[model samples]
Target: MAEKPGLVKTRQERVETRLRQRQVYNERMSKKRRARPRSLNIGDVVLMKNRRPGSKFKTRFESGMWAVTRVKGTLVTVTKGDEVVTRNISCFKRYHGAPADHQESGNNSDHEEGECEFGRVGGTAEHWLASGNLQMGEGLAAQKTTTPGSPVPNQDDVPAEAPAEGSNSEATRRSGLGRYNLRSRLTLPERLRDYVCE
Candidate 1:
């Protein structure tokens, strides 16, 4: 009768140990497994995987492009002209073709057609430019004014002449290592001593 309680206790301990081991195993596997890419949307261009047996020279995906018409769970419906086909999401790879508007306009709407003459000033300008929320000039202008504690200087206050050698101007300081200067100009012997040669 006493053995019954001992057996029950040991059985419960074994089950708990199994649960803990399984939890740890699952955590380890989850780390190794890659997260799936973003789901395909309607109107997305995709290439269907070629399942036919072929030589090494044959391409993995078919040459023709297919436009995603519908996405229902794991299944995706794609059409190329009159021919329509339904296949698993894994069988189709997203195709990033040139935008229809870009083709028609002959210019990319995302990027303005102008040289960015000024250097990027701050994080606000970088963020705005990256997000496409502001144009290059507009972002730079915003950066100049929006920066706290820094007073916006008028056109009259700007210096006409470039800073002389040894001057500690803001532009001089920011230019740093990239700007060619007499100090950075080193002899072959000095270069060998300073830098590690392959």
Candidate 2:
């Protein structure tokens, strides 16, 4: 089909108007950021800003540390384990500490060969176990059972009705094996740790 002579100009004008509006919006927002520019580099670890729920509580500026996987235009992509999230540049703040990946690399060799690959040197799991601060039904036996070499068997490994070989295995299975949430296992960089806690 042939275009009407008058219609072409109208279409071009509409596109131009939209572009102009977008440019204006960008300029207005960028003006504030320009005063203290925080340009993100690849491999720079940043904490994504989290909005608080409707409650009588305020949250910290930085919530979770995510690795800068990619940057395109005004968008940044970050990853934590299997979770990959993309947000606008304004949604993240530059982490003023060692990167999460760097910290993990430094400590990866220190851990025992068969210990669970979760958390930092002193974390919630360790604290709870060491202090013997757990529920009434759950005892220290469950905590001691998961040794470096032999982890608690999964649901597929042992039948619910059947008993295991040792008392440790029995306690582990009864206490619920493979129950730890990976999300909670997330750890922060050492430098950033003190700042966040404060």
Q: lDDT per prediction?
A: 0.60, 0.57
lDDT of 2 by residue, 5-48 (tens): 87566777999999999999988888866744549866665677
Off by over 4 Å in 2: 1-38, 99-198
Across 1-198, the per-residue lDDT of candidate 1 in tens digits comes to 456555555777999999999999988786788546457877666778998838888888886666677899889998776678999898999754222211233333554555221122112223322334322233335444544334456679987987677576666666764454445664457547867543
Which 10-residue span in candidate 2 carries the lowest summed lDDT?
A: 131-140
RMSD of 1: 16.7
Q: Residue 90's C-alpha lDDT in candidate 2? A: 88
Clashes, model 1: 0
**Which parts of model 1 have CA positions greater than 4 angstroms off?**
1-37, 99-198
In the order shown, the candidates' Cα RMSDs to the true structure are 16.7, 24.4
Error of 2 at 177 (Å): 58
Deviation in Å, model 1, residue 135 alpha carbon:
34
- Top candidate on TM-score is 1
